[model samples]
Target chain A: MTYCVGIKLNAGLVFLSDSRTNAGVDHISTFRKMIVYERPGDRFMVLLTAGNLSIAQSVREILQTEQLKDPGGGEPVSIWNARSMFDATRVLGQAVRHVYERDAEALRHSGVEFNVSMIFGGQIRGEGMRLFSVYSAGNFIEATAETPFFQIGESKYGKPVLDRLVRPETSLDEAAKCALVSMDSTMKSNLSVGPPLDLAVYEVDRFASEKLVCIDMSNPYYRMVHSSWGQKLREAFDSVPDPVWQGATDLPLATESCQHKPLRKIGRPEERLI
Target chain B: MTYCVGIKLNAGLVFLSDSRTNAGVDHISTFRKMIVYERPGDRFMVLLTAGNLSIAQSVREILQTEQLKDPGGGEPVSIWNARSMFDATRVLGQAVRHVYERDAEALRHSGVEFNVSMIFGGQIRGEGMRLFSVYSAGNFIEATAETPFFQIGESKYGKPVLDRLVRPETSLDEAAKCALVSMDSTMKSNLSVGPPLDLAVYEVDRFASEKLVCIDMSNPYYRMVHSSWGQKLREAFDSVPDPVWQGATDLPLATESCQHKPLRKIGRPEERLI
Candidate 1:
């Protein structure tokens, strides 16, 4: 299991992924799920993956040299020489297809499915930044302003925060904070998603970023974000007034007759609910 | 899809459920998903349902008359005649199996799985309060002090708060507040679970409860829980400081060379990753 999120905000792109994987409760281990591809002053891209570890490892292993034949007579396009992020993602999709072709049959025989998903986003020298969610079928969808974020793997536990705080106008540093808070909630509820985490931020058009870092339990900023967020959240929850029932106070639940009809309680053995 | 939760606290039991049901996003409708059977001074039980609406509806339809043969050679036991909550749950399980026996094969022919889940909790004369999470196979597990709550259907989004707030010592009204907050989070993230919620609360040793009511968008108390929770959650998120990056602030992400080795970035086309 894994939890990875990539946010494409107007300021830049934010990528965060947990490093834990488990086959079952017994076989738990750490496996980094992020890769940085940067040709300084040219292109800066980050890839985050979730799903079968073997298939992800296979795709990463062969994706480096994997190439796609250009319809026209020209040099084969690879992630390295691709002129646009679109073509770069095509090379990645081809790499995923390559792994599927190589392993799907054998895996099917053993009762396993060939499943993998990825978030690939970055900028090419001549174009604006792009973010894509690549699927197990080698298909992909790009992020747009209306929906500026993509999260895969154990996403729901951490989703409410992302839905509330992230938007196209959110700053790079603020998006980073939202991503860490999202990851913190996920790790608190699910044991499968643990540390150390991999986080990277790319400013729009930089084609290079210095904000690639790893976070373990000991990082000071992360520790503050973790503890402070929990305490504040608890305080916020405690601040909301409890529901006051009928005869106790003046509120909706405080009256015997609410705006809506009350739920019927069967008080007799032979009462017909219909 | 639906979202339903039942919690057993020392003060008593709390139950909450959403009514929205959808076959597809286009085919959405409302159908109440809770049933309360209470005989004052004797017993009180509430049933909350989720999953394949057909199966749940069928289970509910037949459950009223369903009965289980007494292993001790006494009279047949139905929910009405059951002396213990455990025996009552067995009667409910048998009702589920009967529904499965009648519909599972045909449902499989139509490519639908025979799936349904339930949270049934209450008190019976001469016994303590009990709560059970009934599964598709008619099997069930009880809630204990350590794990004091059960959720069915779109559960993950609302789970973190329960993990943080629910305990055996929580008061009945506080548990009801927690349940509404949990439902509010689920509704914010998922359209499949929506308005007109049903909530019920019972006190220890009481066979009936007056805190049974329906809450729609117009209900003032629920409206307060809905709006206040969102505002406080946003405030809590903003209260946490952003991560301090290398050179900007002294933090985990603040140093170019972190305690953990930085993720290796590929800077050249021909760099060997292995």
Candidate 2:
């Protein structure tokens, strides 16, 4: 299992992924799930994956040299030479399909689904930054203003924070911070998503990134963020007033202010359960 | 989909459930998913349901008079006459099995799994309070001191808070508050789990509960909790320092104090993707 997040903001793209892989509780290992592709002033892209290790590894290996035929019939387009991010992602989808063609049938025979998902986001020289969520079927969907982020695997535990904080207007640094916080919550609740995290923060149109780091448990910044966020969250919870059961309290639980009827109780065996 | 949570504490037991039911996005309706069976001085029990609405509805209807054969060869035991909460839950499991026996095959023909899950918790006068998570197969597991609560349906979005805050020592009001906050988070992240929530709080050794409330969006107390919790959570998030990308800042994200190496980049197309 894994937890990986990719956020598309006005400033740039933020990618974060946990580095834990498990076949079962006993067969746990660390595997980096991020790939960075940069052509200096031409294109800068990052791919984050979650699912079967073998398939992801195969797709990553194939994607480097994988090419898609151009509809205009000029030349084969690879991630390196693609004119647009959309075409670059089409090459990635092809790589995924290539892996599936090789492995899906054998995996199905073993009763294992050929499951893999990826987050691919970057900018090409002539176009704006594009973010996509690619599926096990080699199909993909692009992110838009209404939905500015994509998360794959162990996503729900960390989703509330992303829902509350992320928007198209979020800054690059702020989105990175939010992504880390989301990862922190996920790691706290799910042991399968353990550390040494990979983080990449790209500034819009930079065509390169310098803010990439590997964060282990001992990292001072992650440690501080983990402890401070926990303590602060506890404080925030404590600050909320508890429901006052009865009497004239500050915030009464059983007030007539609600338009709905209070819950009905079944005090006898003959009463309706619903 | 639904969201229901039940917590057992030293002070009492707390149960909360939402009232939204959906077969598909177009087929949405409101249906209460909680049931209370209280015999005042003798026993008090709450049943919170999630999963297939028909299955839960059948279980509730059958549970009224459903009986389990006594292994000791006496009269059959029904929830009304069961001496222990364990025996009472066994009767509940039998009720689920009864429904399954009648409906599971037909439902499977329609490609709907006979899916249902329930959180049943309460006190029988002779022994201590008990909490059980009952599965679709009519088997159940009790809550322990380490895992003092159970949640069913759309659970992950709200689980981190429970993992952080719940313990055997948590008070009844605090647990109830926590349950509402948990439900609030679920509702915020998922539209399928919505308002008009049912909440019940029971005190230790008190066979009946006076603290039951139906909270809708218009409820003043719930309104305060919803707004205050959101505000405080944002403030807490703001209080945590953002990652220090570079320089000798107080919380540097890429500090040399950590033992792990920074992420390596692939600068050329020929570099290894692994």
Candidate 3:
């Protein structure tokens, strides 16, 4: 199991991934799921993967050298020398297809689905930052202004905070904070998604970034964030007044105040709400 | 897809279920997923179902009359006549297995898996409150004091809050509020889980309750909860300070005061965390 998220905001790109991988509960191990490719001032791309670790590792191994042939008899297009992020993602898709062709049959014989998903996003010299979610089928979808983020693996536990906080216009630091908070929630609720975490904050158009760090259990900033967020969330929850079932309170629990009808009770076999 | 949660607290029990059901995204409808049975001053039981609606409906139909023959040469045990909550759950499991035996093969031929999950909880006269999560195989796991809650379908998005808030000591109203908050989170993230919702809160010894309500978009309390929670959540998020890469701010992002270690970065392909 893994948890990875990528956010492409107007300010920059934010990527985060957990390092836990498990074949079963008894066979848990740390496996880094992020790869950074940088040719300063030319191209900068980060890949975050989830699903079968072997397949993702194989795809990564093939990706650096995998190429799509030119129909016009020119040099093959690879991630190293793609003109646009679209072309680079196409090369990645080809790499995934190559791995699938090599391993899918044997894995299928053992009843394993060829499951792999990835978030590939970064900036190239000519264009702004772009983010994409690549599926096992070698198909992908790009982030848009309407939905500027993508998540893979243990995504649901952490999604509400992202839904509440992230937007295209969010600041880079704010998005980073939001991502960590989301990760914190996931880690709290799910045993499979554990730290130390890998976090990268890339400023759009820089073509390179120095804001990459690995966070472990002992990290000071994360400790503060984790503890403070949980405490504050509890405070927030408590601040809200509990529903008062009786009359004349600030908020009443009864359905009479609202247009909605009360729930129907079926006391007998033929009793129905409709 | 659906989202239903049941929490067993020392004070009582809380149950919540969304009404949205969809064959596909194109065929969406509202179908209540909760059923309550009460023999005043004797027993109170609630069932929340998720998975194939047909299977659940079948199980529900059979459950009313489903019976298990006593090992001793005596009468049968039906949920209506069970002496204990455990016996009632056993009857529910038998009903599920009956439905599976009738429909699973046909459903499998059509490439649909025979899947259903349920959260059943209540008290039967001589016994204290008990909660069980019933699966398709007719086996069930009871919720304990350590794990006093069970959720079925689209559950993860709503789990973090429940994990944080639910305890054996939690009040019935608080548990109900927590369940609603959990549903709110699930609805915010997944379109498949929606309202109008069915919620019921029952006290441990009270064989009947008036706290059952069908909360719709027009429900005043729900509207207030949704808006206030969303607003308060956002405000809580904003109250957390943003990360400062290198600063002397009151809550420094990269402080050296905690036990956790900073994140490690790999500048080259060969540089690995392991």
Candidate 1 per-residue lDDT over residues B1-274, each given as its tens digit: 8999999999999999999999999999988889999888889999999999888988877778888987789899989889998988998899999999999999999999999999999999999999999999999999999999999999999998888888899888788999999999899899999878999899999888877888888777888888888889888888887766746566656554445677899876677765
Model 2 ranges off by over 4 Å:
A246-250, A257-261, B257-261
The prediction achieving the highest TM-score against the true structure is 2
- Give the C-alpha miss distance for residue B191 in model 1, angstroms: 1.6
Task: Calculate the i-RMS of every candidate, to one decimal place.
Answer: 2.5, 1.9, 3.8
Which of the two candidates, 1 or 2, achieves a greater TM-score against the reference?
A: 2
* Residue-wise C-alpha lDDT for candidate 3, range B1-274, written one tens digit per residue: 9999999998999999999999989999988899988778878889999999999998888888788999997999988789998999999999999998899999999999999999999998888899999999989999999999999999999999998878899888888888888999899999999988888889878888888877777766677788888778878888877777666755545445434444443344444334
Instruction: State every prediction's TM-score relative to the real structure.
Output: 0.95, 0.96, 0.94
Give a tens-digit lDDT track for model 2, residues A1-274. 9999999988899999999999999999999999888888888999999999999999999898898986788899988988988898899999999999999999999999999999999999999999999999888999999999999989999999898888899887778878888999999888999889999999988999988889998888888988888888889999998888668876778877766667776765566765
lDDT comparing candidate 2 with the true structure: 0.89
Q: Say which candidate scores most in DockQ.
A: 2
Q: What's the C-alpha lDDT at position B126 in model 2?
A: 91
Q: Tens digit of lDDT per residue, candidate 2, span B1-274? A: 9999999999989999999999899899989898888888999999999999999999988888888887789999988888887888898898899898999899999999999999999999999999999999999999999999999999999998898888999998888889998999999999999878999999999999878888888777788888888888888888888778878787788867656666777666578864
